[model samples]
Target chain A: MNLAQLQQAFRRWLVNASDESAQLLGSNHVGLAVYQNNYRAQLVGCLEQAFPNLRRWLGEQAFLAASITHIDNHPPHAWTLDAYPEGFHATLKDVFPQNPDVHELAWIESALNEAFVAADAQPLALEALAELDWDTAVLQLTPSLRCHDLTTNAEAIWSALWQETCAPEAVMLEQAGGLLVWRRQFTSRLRQVDALELQAVQQVQADGSFAGLCEFLVQRLGEDAGVMQAGEYLAAWLGSELIVGVRDV
Target chain B: MSTSNPHFSGYGLGLRKEHYCDFLETSVPVDFVEVISENFMVAGGQPRHILRQVRERYPVALHGVSMSIGTAEGLDTDYLRRLKSLVDEIEPLFVSDHLSWSRSGGFNAHDLLPVPYTDEALDRVCANIHQAQDVLGRTMLFENPSSYLAFEGACMTEWEFITAMARRTGCELLLDVNNVFVSASNHGFDALAFLDGIPAERVRQVHLAGHSQGRDILIDSHDSPVCTGVWELYARAMQRLGPVATMIERDDEIPPLAELLQELSMARTLGAAL
Candidate 1:
């Protein structure tokens, strides 16, 4: 066989040792176990790294079984293991249909990792924001910022696990809300945001104009109340270094 | 075994993340430090920050595992571009990858898979190496892989492939001695014969790592200190290719910096004795 044909056969055998391509792997069938083991073990280890808290919640045996299933279904298409675990959240949902919080926990953890290395940009100075015309100024968020709307109490469990405290029991919260994850300096930070704040942040992110943000707030509340709410959110975002820039729209 | 590349000569260690602060805080006695290229290929993060600081203190060697040099689809220009960007920043003393392929079709397996030693495989790998050299504007070093199985195809041996690749592409070789020992034990080939087959002049660096003893094969786990047998083989390698840069690799279960330094000191002592 040629190089391409041999590689194709090897890849096929990796997924399934009983494949017809096994003929090309030579008569030493036992040796094929090494390649198969490495492939599965490396991928499973990647999933574990991507979702440590989830692993603790699900227990090692269950986590490993689910991760193996995920590997069999979605062998990484990316060059680095860093990009391989994005599909694990979907896999967790599939395996734990009754426990939806597992999916949310895995996603929040993955988002934290993504936020840590997404990109680097200077946060807009709070003093500089006062000089801009609020109506025309377009506010930009830090490149490392990520927001997610979650329905489960996964945020509480994730926080406790991250802090090495006694993790609270996973449960569905009465009210659904959103979480904002962003990098401050070198560390990644996340917190739960109220429903109204989530909507306002989403609007500012989409349109990026303070005037539009004010309008979004006004639609949610009255004119005076909306303007005050916008000011409070802006203060929080600035303090968190989530807002990166402001310029004329 | 008459000629040897005189560029780099000293003991070194693989720069793992656990030892980044150790590297930045104090001056380790090693001459150079080798880093896995993929680990630092990020936009902005602590890995990049630590690497920049380490680069200022030590000569860095960019050893990559995802080059997939033996892939039939061809080299990934995007991956190469990122590698070149890093190379431009660090100005690594040497850049290298394995002789094995890591990707097939669109999916990347990430682990280094062994390549069959045949004229067809040789032609493809040589071409890939040539392309890599052209893109990076520097000579590339290809390391020998640890193998678990030999193919059914009747062809040349691994060292013959390495020799031919170096001659054709003008690329240097990273003679991984532990891999040679592991493959020789598993495939029933003479490890010394494998070493003698390669042209010593093309050897630019040597890798020394530990392996796990399995029931039927030795796995290149790189989680322990160098074994007596591998170290003996490394001594033989040093006798053949004098003054080659060497490093101790520990990918898993990495011990304290002092422990690795002790092993590296052995390399220095043994190389000096030779």
Candidate 2:
């Protein structure tokens, strides 16, 4: 085989371990076995490292099974190993169809990983906000911020697992909320927020106007409470370093 | 493409996360530290923050594993761009990758897959090197990788391919001594001949690491202390490629920083004798 053809065959051998591809490469079974083992082992190690809390949550055997299934279905295409775990939630969804907790836990772990490495931005100083036009001002969130809808207490489970405490049993939340992950300075932070706060944050992310967020909350929670809640969330987000910039639209 | 890289003779260690506090908080008695370029290639956060702090203390080298120069298709521009942004910031002592292919056909294996030592493969690697050098605006050091398999090909030896690649592309060489020993043991080739064949002046850096004995092959596992056999080979290498920048690379089962520094001192003692 030529160069491209040879590489394609190697890819096949690594991804599938097919005998045909191996034969085409020549009689090197011992060597090919080494490569095959290295390929799968490296990927397994990547998943294991990326989702340590997920591994603990699912137990060892179940997590390994899920990882194997994911590896079998999805051959990696990204240039960096960090991108490999981004698709693992899909596999978790398929493997644990009844367990939304597992899916959300995976989402939480993956989002935290992404937020840890997302682009750096300076938090907007509270002094800068003093001169802003609330009506036409646009608020820019930190690039590292990631938000996801939540239906289960995966956040609590993840937190307990992280702290090495006895995790509470997974259960469906009476009122679903949201999970937010972002970096403050050098530390990645995760927070579980109420549904209203989640919606307000998402609306602000989409629209980025103080008035727009106020209007969004006003429709959800009457005018007086809505505006008050908006100011509260703004103070909380600013304290958490989530708001990176404020610009006049 | 720039071929000549200024030579610096010093002993250093691969800066892994395990010893980040040791390197950042206290003054490690090493001339330089090498970091995995891909690890710091991210957009932001603690990895970059820690690297910046470390960079302030010691001269750093950017050692990458994802630059699959042996790919038959071509180079990855996005990877190069991210790497260039980092290079501009760190101004690393040396930027290097392996003479192996981890990516092809848009599927990355994330392991250093072997490259057939054929004339066609040589040409392709040279072209890729040229592209990478042109993009980074600096010559890169390509190291010899440990291999478990050797293809049945109609071409020259590994060193011959490397010699031709350096000559044609104006790139430097990162002579991985442990890789040479591992590949030689696995493929049943004369390690000395492989060493004697490469251009000594072109070599700018050296890597000494530990390996494991597999069922039928020696794996470049880099987990244990540097073995006697590899150390002997490194001594021989230093005798030939005098005063080259050398470092100990421990990736898995990392021990305390003091143990690695002790191993690095072995390299220093050997280099001082040379």
Candidate 3:
């Protein structure tokens, strides 16, 4: 057989590992299921690693069934299987339209992955602020700090799951929400944020001065809203490593 | 940590994630390290970060498992770009991939699949290797893979296929001794004859690893320690081929670095004694 024919045969044998393929293996089709089982299991495991939140929400049985079917349709295009789940959330959205949170959860998972492997840079030191002209300086995030604006509390659900908090249901208190997925020391951490807080973070990220950000939020939320209470908020953000780098706009 | 010298320390193991903690915690005298090119290509997480740190400490060899050298479609440009980016960052001692093909029609099987032995295949593989070398800006080494089955229309032996590839492209051979043994046992061919077919001067590096046996054939698992028979084959090949840079590749069932170093040290001893 030519190289293409042989590879095509092998591909047929692989997908139909659990089931059977039509004359793909020539004469020796027996015991191929064992190899097929192992291949499918490993691929599924890779997806689980990529989308732990999806896997948790779907559970093992449902996750495996859905994932195996997905792989059958879209076998990995790259040698790196880690990148396969990049668009899985959209796929799940198509499969389960009623559950928008499931699809949103996939976005959170993909965002967290980007945060984990994002480029390493020097996070802003507490002392750097003292050096910066606070009036003119813009507070930029770590550049690796990622936040996906979603329509449900999927981030909170994902965060809870990471903390081993049960209740994998669609009982989101907040309907319109965003997720904060960022690398805090050695690992990725996720949390849910409101639309106002999401905009506040983005303001800082988009080269808006911290004072300007506070003014923008106050304009949106009202004077009574203490969104600019920098003492507690900055302390919390710095402690959580939710910000990185400082530059002048 | 020195980026000035591109040469790796000579003896290193495949940097797998399961052994990352062990590698960081303990400091062995391993000369350099080899990384699976596709593993960290676009992958992030702890593995990618740790890979950067490891690159700081040791020279790395970017070894790939799925270049699909023998594919009928020939080289894939997109995959080559990713590999080139990795080489630019890691600055590895050498960039090598399997002589086997793991992809066809863009369906990446993600396995070190075997290729049929035909003049058509040999020419395609040689052309692909030359193209790879041109893109990578260095000579590449091709590793022989363990086979579970063989193609019925093979025109030449596996060894002849390999040597002819080298002759066709001016590329080097990796000469995976364990794969020779595994494929030989599976197809009932003389492993020594397979080794003899390759040109010795073209051998830039050698790979000595372990294999697992099945009810009917052997699998190049790279999980266990190098078996007695494979080691014997390695020694026999080294005696004739002379010493070459060798690494221990264990993707599954990875043990302690010290344990692998023990096997690596033995290779050093064998390569030097030759």
Candidate 4:
């Protein structure tokens, strides 16, 4: 066979050592077995690195088994091992339908990884936000900012595992809420978001100008109270450096 | 490829996160440092920040593991683009990757998977190398990988395949002596003959690392110090190919900076003795 055909057959054999491939392997089949073992070990090692907290939460055996399954289904497409095991949380959900928290933990970990390498931008100062014309100004957020709505208490589990302390017992969320993740300088930070903040974040993401934001507030609260709440939320966002720029719309 | 060798030459070590601060704080006595190309392919992060700072003090060689040059489907142009951007930024002394395929069917196995030493495989590899050199506008060094298995219908030896590749593509060679020793021992071939087969002028860099012995075979696990047998082989290579860029690599179970420096010092002593 030619090189292309040989590579195709070898790829299949690596994934599953079938009888035909075994015969084609010819002498020193044990060497082929070593390649197979190294193939699995290296990929599993990459998954463990990408999701250390998830591995800790799941324990060694369960994590290794699940990662092996994930590898079979969704091999890495990117060149870097840092980018391996993408969409693993969805796989986790498939593997463990009863433990929804496992999937949530994976999501949180993945977002943190993203935040670590996201683009850099100097955040717009809080004082700058106050000077903007509330009626015409459009706020721009940091590019690294990410929000996720989850129904499990995954953040607590992540924090505990990260600290290397006794991890907290897993629990379901009382109500569906979300988390806010963004890079503050070189460090990535995560915090829980309430319903009001989630709605405001959604508005900002959907291209809500200051006027639209005040209107969103006025519709939720009375005109006077809405104006006050808008000011407070804007102040909080600017103070956190989540707001990176502003331009007049 | 440049007919001239690298201007800088001395013992070097693989840069790791544990030794990042060590490199930044004080000038490590090593002459140059090598880094994995994929780790620093980021837009903005501490890793890039650290690399920028570290590059100021020492020359770096970008060693890559995922080019998948032997794949029949084709090379990943996107990966090459990212790599070119990094090469432009780092201005490394050498840019190198393995002569093995890591990607097939749109999925990367992340290991240096071996390739058949047939004429067809050699053609594809030379084409990929030529294309990569054209895209980056710089010559690349292709390293030999430690193999656990050989194809049933290979047409030539590994050294023959590499020598032909270098002669045809005008690409230099990264002679991984530890990998030579590993593959030689695993496949029951003479390491000296493998070295003698290669045209020495094409060899631009040499890699020395450690391996582990499994029940039936040896694995190229670069976690420990260079073994005595590999060290003896390295001494032989130094005599045949002089003044090549050499490095001591340790990926897993990394020791302290001092231990690696000591190992690197041993390399210098051996080379000088020869």
What are the per-residue Cα lDDT tens digits for candidate 2 across B137-250? 999999999998888874889999899999899899999999999999998999999889999999999999999989988999999999999899999998999999999999
CAPRI class of candidate 1 = medium
Which of candidates 1 and 3 is the stronger one according to TM-score? Answer: 1
Per-residue lDDT of model 4, residues A1-249, tens digit only: 777766666666677767677666664577878877877888888789889999999999999999989878775777787777567887898899899789878877888888888888898865775566778988888888888887778888898899998888888888888888889888998888876777887788779587888899889998999889888888888888888889887
Ranking by TM-score: 2, 1, 4, 3
Pairs in clash, predicted candidate 4: none
Best by DockQ: 2
Worst window of 10 by summed lDDT in candidate 2 chain B: B1-10
Better of 1 and 3 by lDDT: 1
Best by lDDT: 2
lDDT score of residue A55 within candidate 4:
95
Candidates' C-alpha lDDT: 0.88, 0.93, 0.75, 0.86
Per-model DockQ against the true two-chain complex: 0.72, 0.89, 0.37, 0.68
**Tens digits of per-residue lDDT for model 1 on A1-249?**
788888888888887666587777784666788888899889888888888888888889999999988988887877788999888888888888888788888878898999878778888887886679887999998888788888888898988887889998877778788888889988988889878888888888897988998898888899999999889889989988989999986
Q: Please list the residue runs of candidate 2 whose C-alpha ends up more than 4 Å from where it truly belongs after superposition.
A: none
Candidate 4, residue A69: how far the Cα is off, in Å:
2.3
Candidate 2 backbone clash number: 0
Q: B1-274, model 4: which lDDT tens digit per residue?
A: 4343354557799999999989999879988899999888877878888888989999999999989999988899989999999899999989999999988777677788888898889999999988888888887899999998887778899999999998899888899999999999888899999999998888878899999997687889998899999999999998998877899999999999999999998899988887
How do the residues B82-145 of candidate 1 rate in per-residue lDDT, one tens digit apiece? Answer: 8989998998988999999988898788989988888888999988988888888888889999
